[model samples]
Target chain A: MSGGVLYRPGDSPVHRIPPQVKLLAAFAAVLGVVATPREAFWAFGIDLFVVLAVWSVAGVPVGWFARRAVIEAPFVLLAVVLPFVSGGPRVDVLGVAVSQDGLLAGWNILAKGTLGVLIALTLAATTQPRDLVLGLQRLRAPAWFVTIATLMLRYVDVIAGELRRTRIARISRGDDPRFLWQAGAVARGAGTLFLRSYERGERVHRAMLARGWAGHMPAGPAAPVGALRWVAGGSPALVIATAWAVAAWPV
Target chain B: MTASVAMHLSDGVLDASTSVLFGAVAVAWLAVAAARGRIDVDDRTAPLAGLLAAFLFAMQLLNFPVLPGVSGHLYGGALAAILLGPWVGALCLSVVVVIQALLFADGGLTALGANMTNMALLGTAVGFAVALAARGLARRSRAGLLAVAFLAGLVSTVAASAGFVVEYAIGGQADVSLGGLAGVVIGVHAVIGIGEGVITALAVGAIVRVRPDLIYLVRTSETRELVAA
Candidate 1:
């Protein structure tokens, strides 16, 4: 449940940019990348460069993106398999037979998926978790949805700690959780965790009630976003748009 | 399991049009789930749903061995539905999907709708309906309840994978054969579904023994069965 913020503390201008703007920019960049057809290879290249430029400006290391990009590992595997199994005209690559369409398809997934992951990582790295929540709230996501997501993020660490403690106790008692034979214990442990979490929720509700809380989550006044902040946060997305425009321009 | 449990697709997996279309579907689903959560008879449903969302995220970290080298964790769609009825369960799962994409780079931000529609909507609701039907067929025994959980997990995984196929059929960017993709995806998930079934049944069985009341699926019916016994 590594739900902790990937935000790196920095004095860079990227950090100072409003999270809502950053969020919008991230979404727009991803859409820009996704919208560019696979044939529009130049737009994809520009998208990557824009993301990297922002990355360098933000001062986040390449290692961070590389490590987190492993989340895309399974998809990369899917991409690799596409060429061999895909039904299309076969093309030879270094003496190996491959589907021509599959190669392009694989490349499409690789390029766009990679850029999407990078842009997401950049936003996660530069934005605080609290600000992310605030951004969601300010963006007028359903109040209950925001509240639940915020609360879940808040308690993920706590529940994860509980999991760690439980696992430690189990290991000390000679339980190997990784093996299938011990799945019964794992399931039971999960059940126990669920029970404990549910009860904790009850206690949390009582505490909230005691503090004069209502059913509704109160959102504080949001700070205004200026034109300058939008421009600052939107620079990379602007790059993506320009690249898209160039590709779309009548030749 | 990674394909199924970590169900969110990275960006560009589906074309932008398909992503936006599914995103609209996801938003509408969330609004319905949110509205239902707010107006539910139980006042504590919201907080409970919130904590359950956290619980599912935590449970995901604990993976069980599924094969010679494969392992799978709880996808929690069926588990959530059984514990907290469909609407709240869907909302809870949606929250997890949303957060996983946002904070963690686990899913694509642009693909959020496709991910959400598939996992939160399809993965959850179908499992719940099946489990409810299974419960009726199996009647009021401990074995029956476990069977419901098993069926729920199986149906949920298969259904969710099928959903991926549907989305892929609509806007799959890959030039791969849609039929081939569907077969491979569903085949993998069927095996994954067995492991899901076992874990889900056992997990639900454990809770049924301790606190049957907490599981929304069997709460009243199970209570009635216990009294008869």
Candidate 2:
């Protein structure tokens, strides 16, 4: 659980910027990048430069971001298969004929994914998980969604820790779970966790009722984004706008 | 599942009908939840809900490769519903989808409904029912609960795929056979479901062990307090 990076405290410029701006910028950048066509090599390059710059400004350690970013690389697996799977003209490369469309699809994924991950990483790196949710609500995200997400985040660590212990307990008992036939122990562990989660939810609900929690969750006034922060944050939107316009025009 | 995936807004494809339909559905769900008083408005719950949605959104952005050509993201709709109850869980999941769409453009605005219905509603509702059944059958035994979770998660993933099949039949973009697509979709997803079930059970189990009180899905001792009173 500790291996996964949560919020680490830092005084970088990103830390000082309002979470709302970061939140907004993250969305804008993602949209801009996604809207980019596969052919816009220079557009993707510019996006990469901007994301790296933001990462630096946030003062998030390069190693930490790099490690955390690894979580997203799995989606690249889709790109890998695209060439073989997609129907189109084939090009011979390295003794293998790959679909030209597939290569384009891969580029599309890489570009969109890299930019998407960068935006997400920036948000995750700069803001605490809790603050990020608040920003979503402030940005007009629905209340029910916010609640489930909040609880999930709060409990993810706890649940993950429980899983670790359970695995350890099983191993200590000389259980080797590698064989598919030996999965019962792991399965039983899963059952145990579900009951605990169910019981826990009930308890939490009662506590909520006691505190006058109705169904709909209320909002909080965590500070607002500053003007200068908006300026800095809004800069990406301008860049994206420029790119979008260029992409939109007939070449 | 592909259709359902299409239903949920993704980056490459954008269509007005899908966007409008999805957006409307999202709004409608919120309205319904609000009317049903599912969204708990309080100092503690609201902020936490929003936060959870945000976290889910972020976590989903981090997809892990599950196969040579496939990757998996956090599909926590069922887990969330089991913990928070369907009302809250659905809201939270939809929130995550909406955020992903608007911010990340991960899902399309038009296909939001299809996404919500498949991932949030069908997945969560089906998962909750199965989990509840598991709870009842196990008499609150932890082992029983996990088994239920495994079954529920496994079933729900397929169900989500099924939801897509039905949608595709209705709004078919291609002339492919529904039977063929359904078979392929369900087959692949069933395999994926094992991973989903295991990961979900493990995550939920770990939470139940330490901070069982924090898990919204579990019934608390305080409910007994009310029953005693």
The lDDT for every candidate, in the order shown, is 0.81, 0.62
Regions more than 4 Å wrong, model 2: A1-3, A6-8, A61-64, A92-96, A179-181, A198-227, B1-37, B41-89, B92-118, B125-152, B161-185, B194-229
TM-score against truth, every candidate: 0.94, 0.68
lDDT of 2 by residue, B91-179 (tens): 77776665444333344333457777888777887888787776775347677666776787788888877876776566433234567
TM-score of chain A of each: 0.92, 0.85
lDDT of 2 by residue, A17-103 (tens): 667677777666666776666687788888777777776777766777666555445446645656666556789979899888767
**For residue B172, what is the lDDT in candidate 1?**
80
- Candidate 2 DockQ, CA atoms: 0.17
**Candidate 1 docking DockQ:** 0.62
How would you encode candidate 1's per-residue C-alpha lDDT over A1-251 as one tens digit per residue?
A: 24456778897988988888989999998998888878888788788888878988989988889988888887888788878877778999999999898888888889989999999988888888778878888787766676677778878789888988987898899976555555788788888889999888888877877887656567787689989889888988988988877877777
Score candidate 2 by lDDT: 0.62
- Measured on C-alpha atoms, candidate 1 has an lDDT of 0.81
Best by lDDT: 1
